[model samples]
Target: MTFISLRNVTTLYSLENVSLDIAEGELIVLLGFTGAGKSTLLNVVAGLTEYQGEVYFNQQNMNGIPTERRDVGYLLQDIYLFPHLNTFDNIAFGLRANSCPADEITEKVEAILALLHIGHLKKRYPKDLSGGEKQRVGLARSLVMEPKILLLDEPLASLDPATARNIRKEFKALHNRLNLTTLYVTHDFTEARELADRIVVIINGELKQSGSAQDIFCQPAPEIQEFIAAAN
Candidate 1:
């Protein structure tokens, strides 16, 4: 059931001895304060950050895999939609880049739009759409590529409170529906509670504790307790 595994992973900027395993189809939330190496850990998984340990995807070595070859999808806080492309074009951008067949690209784009419940907004540009809509478009674009693992780095951080909550709900629903293994990075405990099957708390660049929601929330270790207290 294990789909992703990191062993003795160490990142730059003073993060040392970081690691964890993510189950197949599981949603893992990286919980930590800012600059806790949450984003660096995600990039390590995505092959976007350099690390000294081994990363495995589907039990295969990911040591030499480039970001493109790793088949990991990353969703950032900004969504980063192309300025010139409309919603549909942005969604299909990856497909076009990867040289997916034209008919297949259209079908995939349409399916993702419908799956995300934004089929009607495909014609709109990011400028015209609301924050929630733009985020969905970013997600669908990543999902369309059918990456082996999806990585989210505080995808909900920049939204207004109400929008962030609603979008996280939609994201959790989508995660369940698609059943894709996702590594979600966030500082919000509430969002982590809603999305993660496993909670991994990292502080000062090291893993403090990791387990199910009940275990992490109800019986937090001292480091986790300190983190929660500090956050509140």
Candidate 2:
């Protein structure tokens, strides 16, 4: 069943109709260049930005829901690890904010560190860790909350190619293993092809085309065709 549904959705800054229904357990990628409104799309879903139209997730209508109450986790391209806190505390920040039990926080944070194979870095601070390690902690922090949906806005955009590819691999593996309903925004064609069950194209503040990755790659519309050619 569809986990997140956007119907005839329109935002103030955008001119075209925006609609999408993301299925449960699907990793959907919104592929577009900068200024394509990809970031705005994700912000709207995460309830950080206002928009006009219907949006529902996990059966909850999101028309007027506030960002904090939306239960949507967003991992931005800029990784915001706390400089003062160690990896464990950074990952525990969300749970603590939600007033989770002390014992539970300890258990959850430890499990995440182990799960992401970052157990050894639990005591390390953000300044001490590598770019990839920092990202892993950021991801672990988000996933531990078990939000209804995860929105990633060019999460790997700032990384070196090798680091980005490596992180994306871990993301895909974890996403599939957990069957998490996720929305990923990227301009990287390889990232789109590797991580998405379906791909949505956006251009000039509008959604242009959307379909299975294979459908999009094999049968491209004019705009998409031109864009792909240029990207290549």
TM-score per candidate, chains pooled? 0.96, 0.96
What are the per-residue Cα lDDT tens digits for candidate 1 across 1-232? 8899899999768468877888899999999999999999988998887889899998999997999888888987688999789999999999999999999999999999998899999999889988888889999989999987999988888789998988888888888888999989999989988888889999999999999889998999998888888898
For residues 145-190, could you state the per-residue lDDT of candidate 2 as single tens digits? 9887888888888789999998889899899888888999999999
> Which pairs of residues have clashing backbones in candidate 1?
none
Query: What's each prediction's clash count?
Result: 0, 0
- Top candidate by lDDT: 1
lDDT (CA) per prediction: 0.89, 0.88
